[model samples]
Target chain A: MDAAAETTPLLSVRDLRVSFALDEGLVRAVDGTSFDVMPGQVLGVVGESGCGKSVTMRAILQLVERPGRITSGEIRFRRDGEIVDLARLPPRGPVMRDIRGGEIALIPQEPMAAFSPVHTVGEQIIEAILLHGHRWGEKKLSRKDARDITVGLFRDVGISMPSQRVDAYSWQLSGGLRQRAMIAMALSCKPRLLIADEPTTAIDVTTQAQVLALLRDLQAKYNTAIIFITHDLGVIAQMASYVVVMYLGRVMEQGPVDEIFHTPKHPYTQALLRSIPSMTGTTRVALPVISGALPHPFNRPAGCPFHPRCPDVMERCSKAVPSLRPVTPTQLASCFLHHDQAEPS
Target chain B: MSDTAASPLLEVRGLQKFFPITKGFFQRVVGHVRAVDGVDFTVNEGETLGLVGESGCGKTTASRCILRAVDPTGGSINYRTRDGRTVDLATLSPAELRPLRAEIQMIFQDPFGSLNPRMTLLDNVGEPLLVNGMSNRNERTARVAELLRVVGLRPEFMHRFPHAFSGGQRQRIGIARALATNPRLVVADEPVSALDVSVQAQVLNLLLELQSRLKLTFLFVAHDLSVVRHISDRIAVMYVGQLVELAPTDAIFNRPLHPYTAALMRAVPPADPRVRITDGILGGEVPSPAAPPSGCYFHPRCRFAEERCRVEAPALREVTSGRFSRCHFAGELSL
Candidate 1:
């Protein structure tokens, strides 16, 4: 609970480690991940499948399932000039419930399954609003007024014909409409923070673009800190102000969006950036890929997690884990090449 | 630049593939799924034709019909098989299509799912050879090794299982497997979509390099326009169960005729910060193929939809030289 750090970052995570205890042993899904999201700023967490980007966000929500727990770390949420330690809060207590869907709303990857199939989209949105609408008593407005407000929220999220579509079932709606409905539900709570996890992966390219643009516009209008997780760098380029590159349960690098995309310090981040198909007129000759497969959680590497696939691997890289350290004024990387290696110059 | 000046290597004329939607417990024929109502396109020799659309747009079904992997309800699929023999793929039986399978190989979307986990990389690549009654294990090993080398993988890795390789490498293995039979035409369904973005390029470059070296024709189907743009010589945009636009790579990218095509192009997020596309976004999802709206399937969500679009189904007609669009007012649309 650092007050001085609260001046800039709305949410600051430090040395966050999330592990799952299975029959095999402890599997570190998120190992010592740390980053900050300033208010009204969009931070893109980019990584491929099972890279722990989602795990890190789940850790913040304290929604990690059984056997998985935050071993050690600090997740501080700055509100009203006071830093609240999220990690210390009980998972299902009264204080936690107030913040879970109220202060921080989540737009999950798949919109179809995220909402209850039985409940109408409006009902779900109303439930979220009811939970967070503290100032309004149980009967702040009549049922009809609440319905009207829900429709308005839906319209704000760009869902067409909100009046009639409000009564429609989730299955009756198209993928795009369902996604917009999910956004409407998330925004209805008036959360200060929004966690969007691969919100566009399932939809078509055109719909994906619309949803991304909508998220950016909504983020600005709400002045909320957004934690955008996605596998697409093109999307991150369009939306993110800051970027955090994760690989095999660790933060490979973190920096400003431009710096991360143009001049990534970490080899993995650079490889990822180069991999994206560019519309920037830069002819993509074959992109460089990490040499080996990602190390699974069960077969965790002894030292640096990405050492097996690192192009600049050394004898020491396999023997010591590199801590997330500052590579530049605004850039941070966890690689032996950047840590204490011989200067190239 | 006349339409009839040159013939396409593989021409699909009014291709239709409909799955019977049985209702009764006795499996009564109640209705047809209309999976591929009527799709028409051509794949010129040695040219990569990119087939792009959202999921369930009949892209996969159309591919299956081309490869004779599935039966088509109607239409003539004129294609040139190996040994420079031209034949209609749709009418051929499995026994007669055996030789054609060697000529028109398919690389499936999921490398992990497509490959047999229990089998070695060498076996997976060499399966076609073995299946074709190549009893010599040593010959299969040599051929598989050469393919591995061609795909930029070391021969030693052939002994390893697919589970050991990265997604990109696994896709290379899939590509090598498809090429093992020396197929002239390869139908690659979302080949790079399964791999990591960085890995996708490696696989794409490998496919491109292989295409040129072997003088192979490709029918690359994918949902990602960016990947399709990089590799395809020509691109076809599909909506619902029909082709909305067909044009050359640059034509499709720069001057799309169909509204759907234009919207899809605009949807491609510009990699650079300077250029911003004016077309806002496609408003809604593609309508269901089972009950596609009358006339043009895209008319429901199309911004330029008009009275003609609601009543008369637009046929694929030449909008410009070497470009085709299916819209009531194809040229009139501002798109």
Candidate 2:
């Protein structure tokens, strides 16, 4: 868990606590979540909606909205062998502005909302590139030069007829093309870490596969660490090297993708796997739903949040929250079963 | 497969829908966008036929045409109702179609947006019944409660408005509304695509359960292959307003003949992490529906496109007993 190993993590987030000041009380959106992403690693974050996966990823870039603040944790970002504490940086300061897109870039879920309706996609991309390029005292290029690079970036992201597409606004482009434009904009600055939050949710299956493959190839070529957030385990299988299972703002389990998919230890993870419609399995009588919806942010359980829905919940699960214990090599899970066997105090 | 004799509940042939593109203040018709062009398919009684494609590929338009929500410029929609009466739905006048509305219903994609926010859940579900002149409010409320239970929502939720519930709950309300009149055929347009993954399974399961219990025929439109495969007994693949492939679910998944279908299958990620994915095959975006490719619409991205494919529009022809494909080289491709 050392942050300074040979494979130094580009982004190391530990004990991240993000909460919202609601009318009733303080609601924990991301409670003590922790994970890491190394160079060229695609860390898949999977969860049901409202499980705080997006909130945890947003916390890294300090993008959490007002009234919902990061209460504790260190988002230690490594840039050019220099480590900077992201959580400690003052909001809107030069240090924060420099690292926002220069070192850490974000590809949001909904491209329709991400890009302005009036602005052409090329202008949006140029703005992102300028943010990073200007950090090194780079002069603003001519309009033609900016347009050329925008076209090039579009082509790099696999948009056919990039020149024609540069003139179109976000509304004119299809869902898949809009997402590709978002990816192009995110990667235009060439950040070390790319956080793609459900990039393919709106697009079709074919477009999703193409975009994912493009992201993988680009990750390899650029050696950019990625924190990919999605609900589809299928997409995770295709993109992630490591997998993180989240529930009710906590890390339910974390391990390598293969291990997590094949030999999932947590009941929640197993239920998730079983819920997926499989090509190999028998015709399902009924989809095995996870029994209940995710807990409301304000009414999160006192103990294990997943205990109510878990089929194999024990008596002790409802009393105390389980800390993430080491289950296997590079695998950790927060469950009462693990706590029972690994009790030391 | 079950050998039971089942009649076609709905038959659509050579269906075409074109929207005019007008420009400037003069409002001159610039060109026609053939949103749905020359599509044919049949849904058997008590079976789910999934229509799947990328957005703007005309699946939604085809469904809308079948329901006459958007009138088709050409072709036939023959519906055999529950009373053993066959009717050419397209030729019917507005007054004539009113009686048949109870036999066919549609569930829209955005459940929240589709339902009336001003109405209570009970009122939304009861609208269809009320429109059909079911005058008893008590009876309507009873039926709504029954539907709520059928869709796995609590009967008490009927009093609440759509904004009060979560996305999954709103979808269930939408389903209950669709089933209020006990329609023989329901067109569910991307029913669960709007919900979360976990909630999607729940809603899908609920739909499947309702279908079996009510013995309803379904036209399920979705873009997700895995979801379509799970619920659909038969599947249709569409591209640029054309039906490229149609077959049984397993047949389409295991032995898709059309190159476009094969490429689409290859594009979907496997559930198992251990499985190796074919590098994304078809490249480039779908051509404009307004002016599709002259020959085969797919030839632009098709890896196996030939000289003939680029010039000749392939027709949808039966390649096997129950499978249809539109590719000239479909015989050579393994699904």
Candidate 3:
């Protein structure tokens, strides 16, 4: 923890904005989102579907597809005491490519689609190793060396019998094993930062526990910074040290995990927390849901995006947008309820 | 909620569903995938029984068998009809079961796929009425409008197609369709799983309200334990097509009798960050249903398995007044 306080942040995103150019108009998928990922700590980006949690992560890696573009923001990444603006790098250039897979690797949501069916899992993992392994103070690694490294990574992710299982294709493996293989591929380069985008959502609950434990262990061992993106608040609570709450492509709240769970300031964050069914015998009653559906992106409401459903909407809530301001020393909220002179009732 | 006070609304005994695995040019019967093997449970009048398990655990198969959507390989599904007649759904012929179809209906998981894209909300909700000999268009339209109002949708929106509505609204339409025939039993297979978190609560509350208002009995099958706990009176835990534990919702979460149930309870990530899971993390993947382990099916992954558990299967036995378990050391273990 002291190392995190002393050193510069591993990755810093500032006021990031990403928009999609549809025929109708521009849809701001990610708007003015900012957060920091420190060394060896997990930052959870949480929101419902269409809330731009995934888009924010994609913007960091410069992987937003065609028709979607990162219009502005600075994604400054600190590597070897040098800062690089990732948002300025060309999307498919050599420097961006090396930074993407070599310095910051990703474990995508669907392992089935991410992996190739024709090649063996081991062969694909070895290719990743060879592609990025040259940066590890060595000119190059032999095929056997890459294979051994891949096997070691497989074993690290808790895949049993890596030597034999590595030869199996992606479809031949179960959902849990395929996800583990994907994690191994992400960790093959020993990257400084890992972006895990819903990596456990596809697997079963029991396998989810194992994979989460494996990630915590690996993060502790390597001191790798992680940006864990998920819609499940339970998952965010379990895995993340700091949390970012998003809604309608904007940051609603940002704080330490404990504060976010115990003392969420924004009405959107509070309503989202209350909406989840608790497991500890406290959720048999009806959950307090945020009423009304998320407004369509094209017809986004003026002023506060969440005022339509917010329980504590004031007169000022629907007139102008609220910028994120500090509600506490370590917590920020973008709601007028926190900034008003009167106490929130 | 007493099991013996009155006859159960639905009693399923020794239900089994097996799909044949074939290979080669002749497509010979090479093996069998025992999707649901000898599962038994009962749903009382106006009560919700949650059948929960991971993917491919046969909860869906059991529900489908109860509705007779898919013919069961064996066992009896004794359902007491609305007119107070007991009929074995598994043994009934297709011709004989046509009239009984109106008494049992299913609510699917995906609202988008289950609804017809071309049909308006009224047509989708009133199709069951039309098929069941309701020829009067005014009567069906009025009933559809009332049903739409009951589900919190505007009656005027009945003319719109499914694509015009949001996911939550479409789910409401599906519920309206399920209730069109006034079913005695509603088998909702992961009804709210496809909706978002905020919308999930809305649909769940609506289901609970309708269950009470209409006096409907439900067999809710879902993988999420928390959602099941919120809506179900009792829960039956399944593993590899077998009922590992059956108890009230509180007992299932508070004092799980079966090891699998206990492990599953621990596996659910708590919404509180302070509550970290430090012990009893389950290991290994769920064994394939095509070739399950011998003796006790969960023996390979059971941490408390003994030599006897490796060689002998444990029958489902009552551990308490209402709780049941399928463990060799059911009452002995503190789990």
Interface RMSD of each: 2.7, 1.5, 1.2
Give the CA lDDT, 0 to 100, for residue B316 in model 1: 91
Question: By DockQ, who's the top model here?
Answer: 3
Q: What is the lDDT of candidate 2?
A: 0.86
Q: How far out, in Å, is residue A226 in model 1?
A: 1.2
- Tens-place lDDT per residue, model 1, B254-273, is 77789888888788776543
Docking class of 1: acceptable
- Candidate 3 docking: what grade? medium
Task: Write one digit per residue (lDDT tens) for candidate 3, span A1-345.
Answer: 456554678899998889999999989988788888887779999988888989988888899998999998899998876899999999999988998888999999999999999999999989888888776556689889899888888899899999998899999999999999999999999898999999998888998999999999999998888999998999999999999999999899999999999999998888888887788656446678889998888877878888999888888888878888899999998888777532122
> Where does model 3 exceed 4 Å of error?
A1-7, A282-284, A340-345, B1-5
How far does residue B212 in candidate 3 sit from its true spot (Å)?
Answer: 0.8
Q: Which sections of candidate 1 miss by over 4 Å?
A: A1-6, A135-148, A280-285, A288-290, A298-328, A335-345, B1-8, B22-31, B154-161, B273-279, B305-307, B328-334
User: Which pairs clash in model 2?
Assistant: none
A116-231 per-residue lDDT for model 2 (tens digits): 99989988887776656754346776667667888988998889899999889999998888998999988877787899998988787777888888898888888888999999
Which window of ten consecutive residues has the lowest lDDT sum in model 2 chain B?
Answer: B1-10
TM-score, every prediction:
0.90, 0.94, 0.97
Q: What is the lDDT of residue B66 in candidate 1?
A: 91
Please report the candidate that would top lDDT against the real structure. 3
* For model 3 chain A, the run of ten residues with the poorest summed lDDT: A336-345
Q: Give the TM-score of candidate 3.
A: 0.97
The global C-alpha lDDT for each of the candidates, from Candidate 1 onward, is: 0.83, 0.86, 0.90
